[model samples]
Target: MAEICCQEAKSPPATVATASASAAAAAAAVASSVMDRRRRRLEMKRFRLATDLEESAAEYARAGKRQRLQRTASGSPPCPGAAAPAEAETVDPDRCPRYGVSSVCGRRREMEDAVSVRPDFLTGSSSSRSHFFGVFDGHGCSHVATTCQDLMHEAVAEEHEKAAAAAGSGDEEIPWKEVMERSFARLDERAASWATSRSSEEPACRCEQKMPSRCDHVGSTAVVAVVSPTHLVVGNAGDSRAVLSRAGAPVALSVDHKPDRPDELERIQAAGGRVIYWDGARVLGVLAMSRAIGDGYLKPFVTAEPEVTVTERSDADECLILASDGLWDVVTNEMACDVVRACFRSNGPPEPASGEGTSSSGKAVSRAESDKACSDAAMLLAKLALARRSADNVSVVVVDLRRGL
Candidate 1:
């Protein structure tokens, strides 16, 4: 009987084995489907980003073409004028003219800081000898900061040419100081227009909706330096600053347009803006500094005119540092100079040396490396501020003139 049973069992396949094989195949199919779905999702994300980038480039092209047409019709050089649209709202790599500009964002928010550096032209022509550098620190949002970064240099270059023509001076004879002043005004106007256009556009993402009027209130602090073969002209609005390091010491070129300053306070009051003092020494009630771009809501109480200063670069002038408040908050001007001096001592590269500085081998950190350091530093500072319970978005930019010069 046992032998008969064994024969029966062997004669047909067991139901359990068949069921297990089918289940295993089903699980594998499901996993494959899931992996395919994930890949498709990632592809869609990349496609959307690419589309947005393309659209931004198209917008810039259209804007540039329009400016060229207007210039031709007016028979004027393409200085930024009333006809030029506001600066572009997005950051595009094609727009970057300089070689090294390190940027980093904070942990709690998107990066709103922008920087650019153009080496002095060496064509042996009059205009080729001038070097230009600038920093824009955005508050409320990044649109204004990014726009200024892209357009400020071009605007300055155009204005310099226009000023030369107005004075019947050749490019070589153009007055750098006058060019800086006029260019700054033009930058403000263009930035304002850009902000307006951005505000008028319909919201496409949650970020836009949350900050519906970001463009309107999203003003930026600008500090620009024009380094010529003979002198340096600096223009400042808001707190972003440009400092000169002469013989390894610090010399401030731009004034901080804080509401607490007597001049700034008076200007704000004259413009119908009140400065709210907190705890006797702190300023809390004012919306912004005495000067800024955008902040249309505070336009009635603030001015867009920038304060300009020009100085001859003496033999003592070794380096210049242009930075946003982020670096200033954590490091003083003296300290910054010392840091750079230390880096020089270590035979580091010409850029500002921080913990991010390079080794003694002389190979400076990569752009990505510096960028990550900056981002990490800003985030760490923000966290520290939070630990101390401070509320404000942090942004920073550092420009080292020794290397570029």
Candidate 2:
């Protein structure tokens, strides 16, 4: 009887162990199955996201191609939202044709920043077009900047034409560097004449009427960009800047001419001028920038010579941004480019084809949308400067350089 009891108890223990092992194995298998399912779900999510991105990019490309074909076939006018090319100049559809500008006084008592946009400013024999964009920031008064807005493009066009004619053939590349330098020199001379003869010239602004002497000290920073199908030429004379967004990267087209720059400092010192740090580095504790148009009182130290950079256009070129110190002081080049890129991406579809199933207001609707995108980009940058507490006048120009797509 004792032996039988012991055997029975051992049998029960064996059975219990077997059941425990089976349960553990089953639990582990269940857990492994759940993990496998989760992994598959994650992979599926990744695949879907990748597919969506690819589809979106392909759609964008297709849309661009279709729109180009429509425009070519219809021979329609440019989007009404864009600045009209010069009446005498022929518009090249392949060139950069869209741009936006925004300017504001921005926490300052006087508005001194000026922006100029002239599309198709120059036309070559091969029918290539060059668009001109400029941003001028005046220190003592607005007249110098206003003058730049009114006259810089004309001077650039004149100089460019002379250079082209001298080349004898449009097939030959024009020397953009020399052309820009001559144009800037001429502009500076004119500005100097304006300042000296302020009394003879009719009063155009508050400075001339109430503060006539201020005209003598007045100076303006000039940052000009000439965009052609093959090249981009930038001329900078002061603290204002020009930046190109190529492949989503910010490429500074012109370096700011600040008094504290090493080379600028050396040049000023060589000219027997001192750089004083009052508020910021200043030429003789007066002008914040080392070079500018006008400021004849500062003479040899504050030159009108511009630093010109000519960059060959590339497939990756996205857009060009020109802005005064008010925007640069508060916004970084990368940040500005990002904002503009977003604006471009968010732009709606192109205008409907005229002959196809298009409505009467289809072109108008599309034009407004396209125009709003660029203008919004410029306005957004200026507003951001204000939000960041920039103390100077704000001006921004966003030029769309995306070609063919």
Candidate 3:
């Protein structure tokens, strides 16, 4: 895309400027419309993906598994008649119960954002009913983000299993906060190793285009939320964020790590990395985040130590939202919460799954609107960001805590 700005360039006193206020406004409006269309296209594509995931969820229901989001009012008790969620429901340990949507928007031809939703994410009899959701935003390339999407959860699971084993059998609790910290540290080393191994196989060049240093400079920001019946834990490294809806209000679950922040700035300077102001405060004017995975070249300066927080689940905790910076760059926490609450509330009651009946072995199944609250909220948030002209790829994940996914 060509650079087209509404602001008129300074003209010499001798020349009458052709650019007018009305014309600039018209151009700006056109730009916004075009970006909106791009967002719509990406959203349409994500809807198709959501449709597939919906089918996957239906399969679980067909297999004697009911994954429904029980609607409970803010700070209210469970439905007066419905049976309350068991303190320890013996889940299949393989049922994944969450869904999300992702979109590419505005000026970027290729997207570098990746997201994941894993339920029953941990293995063995000890680890049960835990789900993980995340969004990864990449700079320089999508490889790092894609790689993290594929491997980070596995690392977390491995760490989780270790913690579970150490705690011993029979209803012992695991400290997920410590697990998140250790798992993130392990992923940093693993991502670095992945970049190194791939470079060793490729032919070397010094053009900075085909050279190994290209990937060495690429990195991705990660924000993850771990949800279970009793606990909600969030871990973040970079600008991606997680937010929870508490009684229809938005509460930030993770903090954005930026080079401009005092603590982040201090860390960079201590590591002999300059935080130069170039469009914005960047570590050596190259990276915007102070901590992230990958970016082998920026190691020591850009650590992958995630800030982890753990909280007990409460009735006020309605749902959770996770997204990349593209969404946050345009959407405020309050606006996002309001939009989601409205979208979800719009759906009244779930109808029976409608479609031609098919065996559980079949690949496809039908879905209803009532069960699609999270997916709908996620798609709308991405569109909202794009409509606001966020100039980056957008990704969103919405997990229904009431559903225990």
Instruction: Give the winner by TM-score.
Output: 2
List TM-score per model, in order. Answer: 0.59, 0.72, 0.70
Residues 65-156 of candidate 2 have per-residue lDDT tens digits of 55546545655666767543222222244444578889999899989999899988775554677788999999878888888999999988
* Ten-residue stretch with the least lDDT total in model 3: 356-365
Q: What is the lDDT of residue 155 in candidate 3?
A: 85
Best by lDDT: 2
Q: How close is candidate 3 to the true structure, as a TM-score?
A: 0.70
For each predicted model, how many residue pairs clash, with residues at least 3 apart or on different chains?
2, 0, 0
Angstrom error at residue 268, model 2: 0.4
Task: Give the clashing pairs for model 2.
Answer: none
Error of 1 at 57 (Å): 42
lDDT of 1 at 289: 67
Pairs of residues clashing in candidate 1: 86-194, 121-128
lDDT of 1 by residue, 179-252 (tens): 66676677767767765666768864343577766456667888888776556688888887777778878999
lDDT tens digits by residue: candidate 3, 164-273: 78987632377777888898888788777766766656533222355654457778999987776667888999999998889878989898999989998888888988
What is the lDDT, from 0 to 100, of the residue 237 in candidate 1? 83
**RMSD for each of the candidates:** 19.1, 16.1, 13.2
Those runs of model 1 whose alpha carbons end farther than 4 Å from true positions after fitting are 1-101, 120-128, 168-177, 198-200, 204-208, 211-214, 278-286, 348-405
